[model samples]
Target: MKYDVAVLGAGMVGVCVAIHLLQQGRSVLLMDRNDAGEETSYGNAGLLQQEAVRPYEFPHEPSVLLPAAFNLRLDVRYHLTALPKLIQPLWSYFRHCSPRRYESIAQEYGHIINMTLACHQELISAAGAEQLIRKVGWISLYRTAKGRHKGLRTLDAYTRQGVNFKVLNGDELAEIEPAIKGHHAGGVHWQDPWIAGHPGQLVKAYTNLFKQLGGVFVQGDAGSLKRSHQQSWQLRDHQDTLLEVDEIVIALGPWSAEITARFGYRPPMFFKRGYHMHYQYPAGQPRLTRAVQDSEKGYMMTPMDAGLRICTGAELGLRDTPSTPVQIDRAEAIARKLIPLGERLDAEPWRGARPCIPDMKPIIGPLPGAPGLWCAFGHGHQGFTMGPATGKLLAAMMTGQTTDIDMSGFRAERFKKP
Candidate 1:
C-alpha cells in the first residue's frame, strides 16, 4: 500500500497529525503497535491545561532538592539505578531551570499553549467529542497557609502572563467543591483549562473522525521502518504486508527517541514515569465536579467516567523498568483524608511515561538533515493539552503553509549533538 504520509504512533499527537494531513487531502496511514490512546495518552490527569503557560521546571532550592534527594516526597522520586543514564539530561534540565532561561522558555511555551483550547475545540467539534469534555477547569488545592502563600506567589507569575484564575479561600472552596472534605487553606481555580471525562474515548473519537475522513490506521512495528529505494519510507505491518509513504512522521511519545536514534540523531530526551488508579465513591459521598490536584502532595484526583482517578507525581526511571507504584500508594493514603475514596476499581495501577526534553519544549518539525521526515513529541505533562495544536503546526509545516505558531525554540537542532 502507498500513502502520502505515514504517521508512526496512534496516540493523541500522531492521530491529530494524521487528521490534519488528511484534511489537507493527503493520503495518510497512522500506525501504532498498540491500540490508540492506550499508552501515555490514556493515563493523563485528563486536563487540557489551557492555563499552564509555563513548563514544569526543576526546583533548585535546598528545601525542595533535599527532600527529592532522599526521595522523601511523593512529587519527585528517582531510581538509583537510572541515575547514571539520566545525569546528562537532568543536568541540562537543571541548567535550563535557571530563572532567566526558564522565563524565556515559558514565553515560548505559552505561545503554543495559548492555542491548545482552540485547536482541540476544532477537532473535538468535528469529531463529536464535545460530550467527553468539561470546561469547569481544574483546581490546585493547598493544605496549609504557607503552601497557600507560596501558591499565591506562583499565581502572580501566571497572572502576569494573562492566564485567568480565581483565588478561593477555605470556605469558598468548600462551597464550590462540597464533596471535598478537607479544610484546605486555599486553592487556585485555573478557570481556562478543560477536563476530559474519558481521555481514551476522546482519542478514539478523533481516530474515528480520521477514518471517516479517509485516513487509514493500522497496527505495525515502527522499528520495522526503513528507507525505500524510491526514497520513501516503508514499514511492514502486523499482517506482514509492506506499506510505503512519501513522507514519515515519528510521534511515538516516549519511544520517539528510539526511532530518531536509528537515523543517527540523538535529541536530549528522557521519560518521567507516572501511575494512576481509579476508586469508587463512598456511599453518600458526593462526586468531585472538577479535577483537583493536591498541590503539595503531588497527586491529582480527577473524577472520571470510570470513577475518581488518582494520578501520581514524576518517577525518574527507565522507560521499560518494572512498575514501582510507591508514589501511587502514598498518594492514595493522603487522598483518603481529602475525600472519601471507596474500593479500588483496578487490580493494579496503570503506568505510562511522559516524554521530556531538558528545555521542556517539544521537538516539532522536520528532523535536521533528514528530508521527507518530520518529528513531534517531547510534550511531557502537556501531551494531551498540546497535541492538537502541535499537530496543526506540524501539518502546516508539512504542507508548506505558514505555521500557526513560531517553531524556532522547538527545533531538533536546539540540543547539542549527543
Candidate 2:
C-alpha cells in the first residue's frame, strides 16, 4: 500500500516520528526488524533528563579520557585491533576532545537539551503515561574528594550553561539515601526538567495512538529504495513488497550504518552495548525516588515499577553480539555497589546496544544529498531524553511548520566524509 511516509525504524525515535507525522495528517508505515521498542528503548536507565548541561565531551576530556580509557569498569576503551586506516576517525576524535571544541559542542547540545523536558511532559500527558514519570531529581555520587572536585567542575559548567544543582556533603548524602554505602566527600543534586516514564510503554502508547489515528505499521525489514520515473522513490520490504511514499525517515538506530552503507553513505557509527539489571525491592528496602549515579562505579540506579535498575557505561565494539558473561558480571558488580534496594533483586540481566556517533551528537536532519530522505540517529546515550523534541522539530520541518528550537549543529551533512 502506498503511504505518505515510511519510518524505517520502530525504536523510540522512529515511533515518535511516526506519531508526530500522523498528527499532521500524514499516512505512515512504521517498520522494524524486531519487535517495536524492544531494543535500546526497552533496556535504558529510563531518565528523561533535560538538564541542559553540556555534551559528553568537554575541554577537560583529554585528561579524563586518558585515565578512564583504561578503566574497564568505566567502559571507555579503544580497540587496538582496528586497522591503521581508522586513525582518521581517531584523530578527528582527538581534535574534538579539546576543551574549545567541547565548549562549542556543549553549547549546541544545551540548546536542544533544554527543550526535551517540556516536550516530554506534553507527549507523556497526551499519551496518558504520567504515572510512569517522576520528577524527584537526579543524584551524582563520588567516592573521593577528588571525584567531588571533578564533579564540582561539572557543576560549575552546568551552572554557567544555566543548569542549577544542589551540592550535598557525605553526611547529607547518607541521610538522603541511608542504603547507599561509601563515605562520599559530597555529591550534587541536579534538577532534570525532563524525567522519564516507562520508555517502552510510552513508545507502545505512541505507536498505538498512531495506528488508531489511521497510521499503518508494515512489520518487516525495509530494503533499499529506488527513485521512480515520477521523481518519488519506492520503498520495499524484505519480502519484495513494494510500497510508495512521498518521504522517508531513516531512524533505524545502530542498523542505520548498515542500511546507509548500501546507498554509499556509510556513517562513522558503532555500537556501545550497555547492560542493566532490574531488581524487586525486598520489604523494608529503602526506596529511591530519583535516579542516582555512582560516579566512581560508572553506573546509574533508576527506579522502576519492578524495582530499581542499575546500568553501566558502554561495552565498546560488541554491538550486535549477545550479552556475554563478562558484560553481565560487570553490570552486576556495579549494581551491587550503587543500588540500596537490592535485597530481593532478580539475577536476570537486560542488555541493549545503542548507535553511537563518535562526537556523541545525533545526525538529525535531511539525509545527506538525498532529497525526501531524513536522518534521526546516532543519539547515543540521549535517545530517550531527546527523542520527543527531535520528533517535534523534524515533523515541523517536514510539514512546513515553524520549529521551536534552532537545529543548525545537528545537520546530517556534518559527516560528509566519502
Highest lDDT scorer: 1
Q: In angstroms, how far off is 356's CA in candidate 2?
A: 2.0
Task: For residues 1-418, write the lDDT of model 1, one tens digit per residue.
Answer: 8999999999999999999999888999999998899999999999999998999999988989999999998998999999999999999999999999999999999999999999999999999888999999999998899999988988778988899999999999999998889578989999999999899988999999999999999998999999999899889989989998999999999999899888878888898999999999888978889999999888899999999999998999999999999999999998888888999999999999999999999999989878898899999989999999988899999999998778988888776364
Error of 1 at 212 (Å): 0.5
Residue-level lDDT of model 2, residues 192-295, one tens digit each, is 55345466877787677667778877667766567767767687676778888888898888788766666567777766677777777757767777778877
**Residue pair clashes in candidate 1:** none
Q: Give the residue spans of candidate 1 off by over 4 A.
A: 416-418
CA displacement after TM-score superposition, residue 164 of candidate 2 (Å): 2.5
Highest-scoring model, TM-score: 1
lDDT at residue 89 of model 1 (Cα atoms): 95
Candidate 1 C-alpha RMSD relative to the actual structure: 1.0
